[model samples]
Target chain A: MSEDEIEAAAGASVDPDARHAEKMRKKKAVRDKILATKTVEKGLIIVHTGKGKGKSTAAFGMVFRSLGYGLPVAVIQFVKGAWETGERFALERFGDLVSINAMGEGFTWETQDRQRDIAAARRAFETAKDLIRAGEHHLVLLDELNIVLRYDYLPLQEVLNFLTTEKPPHVHVVITGRNAPDGLIEIADLVTEMEMIKHPFRSGVKAQKGIEF
Target chain B: MSEDEIEAAAGASVDPDARHAEKMRKKKAVRDKILATKTVEKGLIIVHTGKGKGKSTAAFGMVFRSLGYGLPVAVIQFVKGAWETGERFALERFGDLVSINAMGEGFTWETQDRQRDIAAARRAFETAKDLIRAGEHHLVLLDELNIVLRYDYLPLQEVLNFLTTEKPPHVHVVITGRNAPDGLIEIADLVTEMEMIKHPFRSGVKAQKGIEF
Candidate 1:
């Protein structure tokens, strides 16, 4: 080992790291001062993209957190019909605090009805609009909604309007799908790209109870 | 201003007023890290107590935010049973994300059946247990669920068990009520006691739509 390398590896070059830490601390101090007085505007839009597991799962966690705060929550599932086992049983717990609307179709394959899919997604949106317009709901989850928009099942501009302009203040919105549109990402405050790390299905492990659903 | 006051303002003040901005920045950093790492658990359980209006409403906001994330979210309402018009249509949007088990009996005033109230609240918890146990849900808002536990309708230990053991690594469980049990607060990662600031009903203002829902 050369003397220069040993010195570089030792405390001789610690000044940069120490300076970086000091800068971070100062930055944090300034931020803490700002937060003490300001009321955080409680609204956000999350877009999930890239092929991965737990996109919907991530959003559901937020729903649980939001309700814990006593805020009104709404959810809309766009594609893939059928009353999910989890949603059916879970929504029953918070009767008034929660709102659920499914397209009421099993899926594109079972129903084999693109028209029906469009109709159901629209109806679900219509119901969702009332909550958004009413301005009572604190969070609204649109599950698989991106797929509907991507497929042209719903008008592009209308949904965009709701997300960008029509939704109420402090009313958070989440739109989840595999391939989110560029427009949605442009407007969204937060975008999560769920890169597929490893999926159970690919491993031949079927979606398990309490883990997948 | 005196010289000391000026100096205090800059160097020695408690600076609560300045903290909001700082907190917001820190929170954003924390939020971003959570978003980036996909490890910042998104959900929270806040017990809003101390005779406040909108305890449940606060929880609803987080629920809405969760939905906005396109997440699967569920709500378990312990009391306030009238199948709300808002909920009737709104829940359809959330689909599997918003799970609500309302007391269905409205308030204690209208309900003469002691057995019914207890049974209804118990039913909500039954579903909440599974939802919490499921482990992948991002957010599970137990709206006013503390009422059931406070009144001894649901077993506190079971609820705690889920919070400690069955809780998903990422899921956020929120409970709202008055006089949260010691055990819950003991186990809670974060607790917010909502003190009554001002209430509309007390001041002769009726609950308004969008604001009070």
Candidate 2:
């Protein structure tokens, strides 16, 4: 149809007041329904694991998305403390809404100290415990947390209890690592096991910038 | 001091325009200079795999996030297809931005048919090819896609070429399956290897509603 014809056709009927009132009524119904449903929702435990990659990064995506809502979030990096450029900048922007505690001593092999890893984990759990119990944080991301449990550096049952029992109903917990404990999975609301069928590292491709951290 | 006296002591006179403009200027500067330097971008491949669980559901989280942005996204399930409550209800809310070509044929084992699997993949790929080539789509999640390559239902090199050569620079692709091909990994900008350390199926946890799809 021509532009003039389409415009005239759309304007064939003129009921401004009636149409406006109808639209208002319909809009009010939708608005009310949304407002009624938008209450405090249940918290979730998102466990990301597998041979395939992108678990920690995916969890961070959730952290950013939740932060986008202006909600409080806490992130604890278990295996890493590289002092990444990303976290340094995010700290300034997100400020108090986001709390981060990295080990500062890179990976375990770099430090090569089992006791140090346990000490670091203990400190992170202390911070995380407060966040979970206080009910202030809407999201908590435990980055590469499974390594702690896998290595027996932290008590799995205790951590699982904290995740299951201590976590406030409104606070979401995201755990990213290679090996997730079965106890956590049993209690988790959502569990993802990423099986590595193929990886770029296998094909001799180093992690690219902006794609991998 | 009394509450009123404390308030008075803390209060300070300030120009509203100066205050607002200062904040705005600071924000703009950060957006242009500081934050611009920090690398925080998303367009990585999330390869959710394993003999474990929740691969497709995890990818759904990203699909949900993208839809929240009001951008177009396409999900192509490779082998298994059924009317899941997730897409039928939540995804439909986004209308044309989401689609599911559920073959209603469940999985390959149930049917014991290779030919049918290949046919379904072709159908899904037809939709995916355009989404990858077209830069308009913000995300394209190929659910169970890696399986097509593993099951040898589709040629891996052809799929890689399409995903690599034809992919729009800004568009992001997510491939989920038990095994992703080596070629796909080699070409992928971001490849995830999900290693399954523990699974609930071994511990006798039947797939429950709201926990496992």
Candidate 3:
């Protein structure tokens, strides 16, 4: 419709409010149409990767949301060592509903042992495979699994095969880390790259407890 | 140092493992020095903005993390209406420790009432100001307040002034949404832009319960 016709259809006046309302009415109609077309539902392969922070934090948020529904969740930390973190302590309050396994010795640089890192990654992957195969949990978070894959600690093809073929249809898998592989991204239903605009660390701010951890 | 000298310092032999360990040690020393210099401790202004998902999800993760620390948190959602969400249900389990106020009627497109939208924004901001002023909560999340500011429903200068000058020193404030104001970004200690690489919505997947909500 022409501008004048659209305005008249919204209202018989030149009021801006009426024009905006009419514009929104058209937009909502389009949105509702799109919403109607989206009908597929199943567990998703979600990937969070980039240099910026919050990759794992967002995944943890999903875990928390899932817990609200009394759903079981398994968190497998592949890079961070077994250490006390605020999220870990908080999630532990849910008891058996939450399972967190910090499998890595530490960062690769900290360990500086390729063989040892590979061993740790393999062990973590084994635990993850068991959890996914059992299909007891609603969500399984593979925290930092991409880092291990990037370093070639675990075979990428093998991991992808299991996820695509063996993962239960009802289980949602969230994989988080920097530098997620192309294959993983291609298979992931949703992928978000947290781009760092500004970080406090660059301003000499240390990672604060309850914030960074 | 020369390449040969650097290699000799790491290890006399040309073993990759030894060289890697030595390189890590040097890196550790530098990292330690930087950590030592970052002795400042104070609450931060965190901003998560971009077109991708997980902006509020990350903030809610922080809330969950804070709850783990037994910290009080207040969540003020400015754009989303008071609706049943998994995260809201999850947080309500924390009882008095969590206070959520879903003040917006809905998105501006849905409401199509600028005056009413402004009123809602004002009321929400008033509640936010009160929570921040009380200084009782460890973290206060202004979820989607950026959208209000972006639409000019609330005075950006007034909000920035309060955040900069009147906000309690001990309370961390997290503001999330797309198109965050430049002034807010200038004052924020940490800012992350969630860049969308792939979204399932484009692939005809509906927003699933316990995942999108």
Candidate 4:
């Protein structure tokens, strides 16, 4: 017996399998149409910001991916300082393909000096500018830059101008931190805001070495 | 002149710098107190979910971090299949430190057969169970397992039972996909929902080599 006839004899109103297949066929056609229209290829100004974690981790994931292709990448930690992180240690194995410069003194509360914080931010931004202008790296990550920008340690206008006008067309930039500025969000090609639904910290779980760092 | 006296003479009601310093000092004390209470250490059930990018990317980030420490890790791709992704390629360089199993035939739409999809999921879950029970790997990433569970391809209770009862301690499990089950989220230690604020696909920009894949 045919599948539809068997289903009808089995007291089913319709052949669910055939119906689902037909539905998926239409969906695939729509998806193909949309995907075919997307042909543009260029470096994206990607932003990862929110209260949750993985802002820098996701950026580092991209860095590792870039390194896999033997692509040059630069990482400028604007506010994390030069702590020995698991990612840092791992990326170091890549040798000359990756350059990670943790330029911040520490968190603002840890520093507690606005002038010193501003100076550090300025220095980091200078490094970022040099890297982006040189276009030597395929991917440049401004880690925790949104934190610096949120605190007004660096001039937002100057940073925006540099990113929009001075950055090379082929250099992909990933800016990550909480409280991304509206101006930065406006110009970003892609943005993902990670929302913290539940955290182990709330249950008195300390951050592990390899996991958190 | 004393700093406070100079500020007073300059018509400032209070020394802003001194007040700021005092405020930060108090904040630090509170933070330290909370941090001191957190001493628990164990494997974490981390969930990366929601309708945004980076669910799998962030999981892969943790995988890379784990590999950096020379930890054994296994990645079971439930829906992605054996595509030539940048992460897969990059992770391959880790050799025996990492094992990536792309067991899915494809998405449900691509397969267009519910029974086949269910069989594939069952097989993949069996592999996951074996890995978790063996406790051989320090980290196990069930990439897109949520997609399988969401479709009811595998029994959720069975999966939950295995995770809670059968899995060995000290094996950190990272589950990635959208619409993670409430039961899984309830048992998870850390859950971050990646919210899509904007996407380049809307602007006709296709996924790039290193950035997306």
lDDT of the structure predicted as candidate 1: 0.61
lDDT of 4 by residue, A1-213 (tens): 999789788765566676666666777888889999899998889999999978888888888888888899999989864235678767877899998888998887787777787899999999999999999999999999998998888999999999999999999999999999999999999999999999999888897866786
Q: lDDT by residue for model 3 over A107-194, one digit each (tens)?
A: 8777878788899999999999999999999999999999899988999999999999999998999999999999999999999999
DockQ for every model, please: 0.02, 0.05, 0.67, 0.63
Model 1 ranges with Cα > 4 A deviation: A1-42, A81-83, B1-213
For every model in order, the fraction of real contacts preserved is: 0.00, 0.10, 0.68, 0.63
Top-scoring candidate (DockQ): 3
Docking quality of model 1: it rates as incorrect
Candidate 1, residues B13-101, lDDT tens digits: the string is 35543443344455567645544533232334445443444345445545555555566777767677422434434455567766666
The 0-to-1 C-alpha lDDT of every candidate, in the order given, reads 0.61, 0.63, 0.88, 0.86
* Deviating ranges (above 4 Å) for candidate 3: A1-13, A81-83, B1-13, B81-83
When candidate 4 is compared with the true two-chain complex, its DockQ is 0.63
Q: In terms of docking quality, how is candidate 2 classified?
A: incorrect
lDDT by residue for model 2 over B95-155, one digit each (tens)? 8876555532455544444456577777778777866676666778887887677767778
Task: Please list the residue runs of candidate 2 whose C-alpha ends up more than 4 Å from where it truly belongs after superposition.
Answer: A1-53, A56-174, A177-213, B1-46, B81-83
What's the ranking of the predictions by lDDT, best on top? 3, 4, 2, 1
Q: Which candidate has the highest lDDT of all?
A: 3
Which digits, one per residue and each the tens of the lDDT, describe model 2 over residues A1-213? Answer: 987688668764245444444454566676556555544336777788765555665565455545545567787777774225443343345578788867424465445455666788887778778877888887788887887788677899889888777788767788878778888777876666655545444334444332343
Measured against the true structure, the TM-scores of the candidates, in listed sequence, are: 0.46, 0.51, 0.93, 0.92
Worst lDDT run of 10 residues, candidate 1 chain B, spans B197-206
